[model samples]
Target: MLPNNKIPEHLRSWSVPWPLYMPTFATPPELQPGPGLDASVAAGWAEPAFFPAVNDWPQRQAAALIPFQVVGGRPRNPSGRTGYTGRRLGRWGENQAADPIVTTGAGADRRVLLIRRDDCGQWAIPGGMVDPGETVPAALVRELREETGVDLAGYRAQILTTTYVDDPRNTDESWVVSTVAHYRLPETSPATAGSDALEARWWPFADLDTLLVAVADGGGRLYAAHRRLLGLCGGGR
Candidate 1:
């Protein structure tokens, strides 16, 4: 329910390392994404290599897209626990969605389209959820319109590689979830509509960081996704 960008200390791996955090939780059930999820609850996959322990990970159902990480716990500080209070299991809701990285040309006057997130004051590509039954492509286009107000039926576009975005969300010491990600693109002269965004317009590459960006996750994956988009746009220095 809280803004994901402001990841809580406990829910964050930054709290502690995996070696100390992995042993803090009770055993959990296996949960995988798709088909078995209720409309309100969606499951995601776990890469076995993510865990240092040899236990079987349960398929999980998270409310949204979030990354899960193994982190160590604190003792006698804020919560005033004695010692080793078991590991903290944490992750974000794994939201599966397509990011439509629409770009215009990069001539001296070129620019890329972006949407301002009123919630966090961050800039994010026009993207949203993958509605059930609708293919990714359609969902991408539809979400672009809903979020950034762009429709590309008659525009030139390309579907980039499929990617996964993991943003850590929960801190129950009993559950975790990892979200998946994808990308789509349509080239145009930076056009956008819809009141969902604080403002939508063409942004020069040089001023990208100045904008408050609110994409799903962080780390190299997030940076790399934008980098790949720049590569697709072909005007980065």
Candidate 2:
């Protein structure tokens, strides 16, 4: 469901900034070799099966070889620390994306449901990229179902916010992902759906840290979630 050509402007900010698309010898933070580098980094688990693409590029652009990089057995930005150098084509390679932060939790007496990413096996809010053409909300719901098998029929999600997480592989490029978290009665959540999640389950609000996986900005999003929830509880009046 990828969009035809109109790149989503909202997603651009969610990726690595244009100026910081360089190696550590040049960029800041340089993606430290710590918890963020080890588990927080979103691994590209997209194989031909998950992400199907037409093979007409080679023939359509016959003699065109873009300057890019080939890292982690995948093509990347040539100037990227990953050393991906190939012909450049589109202004933004693959732009615009979305994610689903479907959570079920309450306050001191509440619990939050989470899953273990099969690829990384780390607990994370279920999410994925928003396809082209599909509306952000629709994509959010689709991804949520695909990953967890839970239904969001009654949850008309509003934008919680947008975030940009760092990508170590493409120090020259960025992975932009928009997240949509839908709240519901804990009983209706996938953790209770039985046949859904990989290992669908919930945790006490005080136990969120046990997972150790960071959200956008390395735990920044997690804090944001709590703060926003607090405002709602106070009636934000």
Q: What TM-score, to 2 decimals, does candidate 2 have? A: 0.48
Q: Put down candidate 1 lDDT per residue, 86-112, tens digits, no spaces.
A: 222222223356667666555554566
Residue 205 local lDDT, model 2: 53
Q: Each prediction's Cα lDDT score?
A: 0.43, 0.40
Candidate 2 whole-model C-alpha lDDT, 0 to 1: 0.40
Model 2, residue 43: C-alpha shift (Å): 17
Residue by residue across 112-206, what tens digits does model 2's lDDT show?
54555554334545555555456777776776666666777777675665544222222233333344444555563444322223455555555
Quote each prediction's TM-score.
0.48, 0.48
TM accuracy, model 1: 0.48
- Listing every candidate in turn, what is its Cα RMSD in Å to the true structure after a full C-alpha superposition? 11.1, 12.4
101 Cα displacement, candidate 2 (Å): 2.9
